[model samples]
Target: MAGISGLKVIVKKNKMKIVVLISILVLSVSCRNKEIKSVEKIDTSKETEEIISENKSKPDTSYTTDIPHIEDFQNEVMKEEDILFNGRLKKYFTLSEFETVFGQNDSIKLLLEEEPCYTIFENKDGSVDPEDKYLYKEGSRFENSKDKVAVDEFKFTKSNFVLFKGIRLDSSTSISDLQKIFPNATKNIGSMDVYKEGKVQVIQLREDENNVSDGHINIFIKNGKLYSMHWWYPC
Candidate 1:
C-alpha cells in the first residue's frame, strides 16, 4: 500500500508542474500581442500628429474674397474751348495788357506793401456791368520787379456771364451741367470761405487733368448754380 501511494504522489507533482508551465506560456504570448498592438497604436498616433501639424503650417487666404474691384478713371486733357468767360483771356494776364484791353481799373490798392506785394483790382463804378476784380502779385516772376506783375487770381461777382459752350449761372443750371463743361476738373480741397465746404461742390480746373501740380481754376457751386470762381497760380 505505501509503495502505491508514493507513486501516486509523484504523478500528482508532475501534473502540477505541467499546469504551471502551460499558464506561463499563455501569459508570455498575451504580453507579446499587447506589445505589438501598442507599437502599432504609437505609429498611427505619430502619423496623425504629423498630418495635423502640416495642415496648421499652411496659410489661409480668405480675406480678399469679398472685396469689390474698382475701375480706373479715364482723364481727358483740357481744350481751348474749355476756357471760362469769353474764352479769349489767358492765365497770368499782365497788368499792362489788362489795362490796355479793359481800360483803367475802377480802384487799385496795394494789399501787401512788402517786396512781393499783392495788388487788388476793384470795379465799383457802374460803368462796366459786372462786379469784376483781379488780384495781381508783384514780382511774381522776378524778385522786386514791377514788370513781372502777374494776375494771380480774379473774381467775377454779381454777373450772369456765360462760359465755354454757353454755360452760365442760372436757376436752370445744375451741377451736372457744370461737370459737363469741365469734365477733367477734380474736387477742390482748398479754402472756400463763402460757402460750407461740405454743402458745396468745388472743382479745380486744370490745363491737363493728368498734371495736377500746375496752375488751375477753382469753381464754386451753390444751390445747383455757379456761385464764384477764381484762377490760382500758386505764387
Candidate 2:
C-alpha cells in the first residue's frame, strides 16, 4: 500500500512542474509584445515631428500685403491734370492771358535769333537794358510752352516776377527757399542753382563773378537779390 502512495505523489509533483513552465512562457510573450508596441509609438512620434519641422522651413508664397497694384499707379498719374496753379486748374497762361496780366508794354519783343524761340520783355525805362530780359513764348500759352507744344523754350531774365503757382520770386529768393520749393535743385556754383524737371532744365540761378552763362533758364543775382532770370528751351 505504501509503494502505491509514493507513485501517486510523484505524478502530482510532475503536473505542478508542467503548469509552472506554461505560466513562464505566457508571461515572456506578453512582455515582448508590450516592448514592441512601445518602440512603434516612439517611431511614430519622431515621424510626426519631422513632418512638422519640414513644413515650418518652407516659405509662404501666398502672402502679398503692402504691394501696390498697377491700377493704383495709373490712377495717381491720371490725377496730374488736376494740379492747381494761380488759384485755378490752369497750370500756365496763354499769350492773350499774359498780355492781359502785364499789359501791352513796349518793352516786350520777339527774339528770332534765340534758339528754341523766345520773346524778350525788358523794363522800358531802365538803363543798360536792365541787364535782364524776361523771355516767353510769342503766341502760345505757358502750358503749351512747358509741354513743348508751342514755343521751344522760355525763361525770365528779370527776377521781380510773380509767376504761376503764386511763386513770387526775385534774386532775393534765397537758395534755401528755392530748395524748399524745388527739392531737386542741384548746386552749380556759389549761390548758383539749377533745377531740372523731366530731363529739361526748367530753372537756373546764377551768381558768379566770372560771368559764366550757359543754361536754358538762367537767374543772375547780385548783392544777394535776384538780378535777372533767363528762361529758354533746349532743342
Candidate 3:
C-alpha cells in the first residue's frame, strides 16, 4: 500500500513538471514573436527616415517666369526712323541685306538719291575717289556744311563693336550693334562704349554728298538736339 502511494505521488510530480515545461515553451514562442514585430517596426522607421533625409538633401530648381515686352524697343525704332529721315542725324550706312530676326521691322528703302550727291566717280575697287575731277558737286557740300553741329563729351569705355557686321540697325539693335558694325572705326572711336555717354544717341546722319565715302561716317550730338552733320558720305 505505501509503494502504491509513493508511485501516485511521483506521477503527480511528473504531471506538474510537464505543465511547467509547456507553459515555458508557450512563453518563449510569444517572446520570439514580439521580438520579430519589434525588429519589423525598427526597419520600417529606418526606411521612413532615409526617405525624409533624401528629400531634404535635394534642392528644388523649377523655372517659371515671363519674358519682357519690347515696347521700349519699338519706340526706339520709331525714333531712329525719324532721325534717319530728319536732317539732324549724320551717320553713314549702306543697304542692310540682313533681315530682321524678330519679325519686327522688315522692309527698308534702298535709295541712292538719299545721299544727295550730284556726281559719283565710278572706281574699280569698293572705294571712293575724293579727287576725281570728273565728279564735282561743290554746291551740295556747301549747303550741307551750313547745317552742321559740334559734338559734346560723354562717358566712354571700351568698345564691343566687333560683334556686329554692318552699319544698319533695327529697333531691336542696341549699342552692341553699333560696336560690331565697324571694327575698324570702333577702334577709331576712342571713347569706346558710345552709350556710356547716356546723352549720345545714334540719330540721323549728316553727310557731304560730293566728298565721296565708302562706308559709315560719324556725326556728333550736342545738348538734347542734333545739329547738322559731317560725314564724307555713306552712313
Top-TM-score structure, candidate number: 1
Please, what are the lDDT tens digits per residue for candidate 3 over residues 1-235? 9999999999999999999999999999999999999999999999999999999898865554465554312211111233332122322222121111111222222223334443233345643343322111210121211122111111111210111122433223444444443333333332222433444433422222332334333433334232222333432
Candidate 3: which stretches are off by over 4 Å?
62-235
* lDDT per residue as tens, model 2, 1-235: 9999999999999999999999999999999999999999999999999999998898877796898765332211101133222233232455565454434433433232332232333224422132233234322123222212122233323412434345555435665666555443334424444343222222343222232433234444444444444344332
- Candidate 1 vs candidate 2, TM-score winner: 1
TM-score of 1: 0.39
Ranking by TM-score: 1, 2, 3
lDDT of 1 at 81: 50
Whose lDDT is greatest here? 1
**How many pairs of residues collide in each model?**
0, 10, 15
What is candidate 2's TM-score against the reference? 0.35
Estimate the TM-score of every prediction. Answer: 0.39, 0.35, 0.32
> Taking the tens digit of each residue's C-alpha lDDT, what string does model 1 give over 1-235?
9999999999999999999999999999999999999999999999999999998898876665755443123333433355443234443355676555444455444433332222223224412213223333221111112433333433334432335544444435567775665454543233455522455656776656456556655666666666555545543
| Model 3 TM-score relative to the real fold | 0.32
